[model samples]
Target: MIPETLLIEYNATLKTFDKDEIIFSEGEFARNYYQVKHGIIKMNNFNDDAKEFIQGIFYKRQSFGEPPLFIDVKYPANATAIEKSTIYILPKEKFYKLLQNNKEVHFKITESLAKRLYYKAIIASEISSQEPSHRILRFFDYLKNDVFKQEGKFTLKINYTRQQISDILGLRVETVIRTIKQLEKQGEVKIENRKVYR
Candidate 1:
């Protein structure tokens, strides 16, 4: 958490976005980091083939944009609000100052980065050798372990459509649908009007 004084000082400068609105674009200046106060945002990249790959779908109370901004590089992914959202934006210099003044925040950010890297490593590992079905299963298992809110039932802010999900996991939409149906048949999930309940 940012210090109370700092939050107050910075609170008035934040911005809000509606569903599907772009928060930032790839190759944009990395001058600010955003703290999500409400709703969800999806971060993704487009390959040379012009296909979008889902990198992450972050929910409320999460923060992103540090890695690129810290290195003073352009944003590597595009961030879009998946739902109506409010986010606080702190300029790079002020953010660094906040980190310096709050040791806990510094520790927390480092820990977050390490965890993200671990997940990225897992995705990379699977992409190298795993079949599409296995990859999707592993991805879902990861959600169950890390992001799911309950046992036996998972509710996620799935910002991507089936096509986007298919692209992310390198599976065809038909394959993704078939795999999802398999899961549904096994009572692992209930697919009803895009609300995946498990």
Candidate 2:
């Protein structure tokens, strides 16, 4: 993600939304670059049956909905506030200009987009070819190493709830619950105080 200082210096404005508020809907023109100042935002899609699938979650300081801005297209999915949140918004033209002027920031954005693409490819393979436990572990391991970046020999706290994990992994919540217990039994993960640890 780009630095907050850069966002501010580029004349980014702050916007706030309540929980469950839609920041932008699918098919809307991606006119602004958004960075989370506080709370969480989720990018999601719905199937014909109305089942929601989470594309990704953005935590504090993380940016969301960038591919459209770069590719000159509408948003492919909806972004919603998971809680009361503040976001820094940079107009699309200004955002493009800033990236043009900042080579390092552009490289960083490229790396981020590359990582997202890798995750999508891996998840797609998991969904098509792997078992439930393998899919869950692959996601947990990726989250630990890439997102959380944990290293020491201790329990790592996870931010996503089981239901959220299920949604993200395209599995049922019941399957997630059962799989988690199986993982605990295998000492792959721990369930302590009703919280998950990797």
Per-candidate Cα lDDT values, in order, are: 0.77, 0.92
Give the clash total for candidate 1. Answer: 0
The candidate that achieves the highest TM-score relative to the unseen native structure: 2
- The local lDDT score (0 to 100) that residue 105 gets in candidate 1 is 82
lDDT of 1 by residue, 50-130 (tens): 887888887666888779977778888999988899988888877887778778888988988887888889888888899
Candidate 1, after superposition: displacement of residue 123 in Å? Answer: 1.0
Q: Model 2: runs farther than 4 Å from truth?
A: none
Best lDDT among the predictions, by candidate number: 2
TM-score of each: 0.85, 0.97
The worst-scoring run of ten residues by lDDT in candidate 1 lies at: 3-12
**How high is the lDDT of residue 146 in model 2?**
82
Off by over 4 Å in 1: 1-6, 9-12, 152-160, 192-194
Q: After superposition, how far is residue 78 of candidate 2 from its true place, in Å?
A: 0.3
